[model samples]
Target: MTSNFLIFDCDGVLADTERDGHLPAFNETFEHFGAPIRWSQDDYAELLRIGGGKERLASVLTPELVKEAGLPTDPRQQRDVVLSWHAYKTARYTDMVRAGRLPGRPGVARIVAEAHDAGWGLAVASTSAEESVRAVLEHVVGPELSTHFSVFAGDDVAAKKPAPDIYQLALAQLGASSTSAIVIEDSHVGLTAALAAGLVTVVTQSSYTADEDFSGAALVVSSLGDYPADPTVVLDSPHGTAIVGHVGIDDLIRVRAAALSANSTPGR
Candidate 1:
């Protein structure tokens, strides 16, 4: 049996972890390992284009860094070295999450609770490491709601986003149809992946993803909006669904409903 699904992307969507948590963790890992590779905010903004953290680390391996960091020169050995760095970084980042250094995005907790109570299939589909994603999910939505989520992350699929493999795997595991799932994503690559998998996506722009394209998202908001504290502002809404202070499960259903109707109409 299939159920309606609400899938979330871990990093930016669940919490604004990329800037405060991940970036610092990566730097700290490099420092702890004596690697001279340190990325500034602007550098990470560009690096965000890459999908997986391992890939991102691989992308920055320079001859100078290899020698200075005492990394193995052999290709296979260097791959192992990069893997170790990523593992360490994941640990550091998860620690930050467990310590509550990163705050959950505005309405993420509220929406998660509401969706769970409504019996919507909930999952997190991300390219981040499983433990890292789990840590952030638990920290943001709490240990109680986190238990209800199915997490599909890291090498769960060979291809990462901007590729649909992760989302496709999630759909299969969740026993959900494309029209029955709504994805909350915070980056252009994440949005592209969810769209390619035929799921309706909503973009809640993060610190690093505000200017990226989100033309296909059913809704694009500043944050999910937590009532009076942080009201979500619609950046782009393809379905034109009205959002009050925050987005709830009802808004998600309406968005998916509108998406289905549009796709079902003639000439669409």
Candidate 2:
């Protein structure tokens, strides 16, 4: 069966916005609030395991960091502080998008144009804030493609990636069944979310997520594709070759075909 909708996770998949975009925005927010918490690339690479911004912050807060930062030791107050920081970080992240500091991932424009022309429904389901996601989408696909997408993002639901709530919401809102949707992700968390929702997923490893596991993805790749200026390079792996450029509808159709075939076979 062919996937009727292509679902995207924003941060690493649509844009290589983490190092140049998100990390600096987060540090700027921490500075503005006079907080001692500043996440370096190395620090955030570890935190990426946690899935949500506020959740990641909560994970690292110890009695010592709280005391040193003059934060309340109580769990509720800690939650509030993390939420406040995330709100500020989101604003700064959006500001960076507005300033054009972040560029969409290579081949994003080409693939989106191809999909749009083929009449495929497009949507972005991400843990990132809606404003930030929409900004990046606009930058990548222009206003027309941006407007065509149904966005389900931050805080609209109770749980983040690896929980399937966001993807579930996107599927419901878009009236797409799991079998009829394909998700594009960069992290294991996002991959887990899509798989749990019973949708096939494709992974494009980003800098922060390259070493993470992607056992269940239908396809795992280095990037979507390279353009004229940038050559496409596929990574060889023990499992298979990682897709890189101009991966078309037929490629995705093959993935679904393989998945269906694998499922229908009797036990050995």
Candidate 3:
């Protein structure tokens, strides 16, 4: 079926949350905790491959790092430290959101209003905390449109992106089937998760994800754009031809219709 639901991946897809918002927040958290740890840009870029904030924090706990940072040795204490760090990071990120530091991507607010008015089910699925997601959504689309989004984030599922758990949870909670929904994602992992759930996906490049492979995306663009001031440059498309510049809500509908048509075809 043509997509009646639109699911958004937070962070990169909604706003450029990773570089400006999240990175600083993480650094601030590390400083506040008196940990001799600070992830340089390159270091954090590698860490983004991990799913959640706590997961990312835990991933840095090698024996050397643990010793250098003087982190708790006990497993329980280690887990607690990561949790506390994540909580502080989340708060800092939310503060950044509230401060209007992260602006919505080119067409995010426009497309969201369009989708909401067209009666599409709107939602955000992410590994970030629900509070952080809400803050970013509200900051981007304002309180009214933000309310229309059903958020599935943080520890909402046992597994994170690339595992299909978060997208599956979103589909279930939105009362929609994967075939009836389209997901907008920025990272390869996010695209894989959505695709694994059987949803069509559109990729808009983000800071850290631009060079990553996005082999299965139905459409790939620099950003979901509004044209003129921030026109979108098509990076890839279903057919091997040059695509027109700038993508709006109508382009999304065409993409969804094309996906539905393809899915209905018989295959081996």
| Candidate 2 off by > 4 Å | 1-3, 236-245
Candidate 3, superposed: residue stretches over 4 Å from native: 1-3, 240-245, 263-268
Compose the digit string of candidate 2's lDDT tens values, residues 151-170. 99988888888899999999
Q: Model 3: how far is 148 from its true place, Å?
A: 0.6
lDDT (0 to 1) per candidate:
0.91, 0.80, 0.88
The Cα RMSD in angstroms, rounded to one decimal, for candidate 1 relative to the true structure is 1.3
Off by over 4 Å in 1: 67-70
**Candidate 1 local lDDT, 192-267, one digit each (tens):** 9998999899899999998898878888999888888888898877777989988988998898888878878999
The residue pairs that clash in candidate 3, if any, are none
The best candidate in terms of TM-score: 1
| Residue range with the least summed lDDT across 10 consecutive positions in model 2 | 235-244
Cα-based RMSD of candidate 3: 2.0
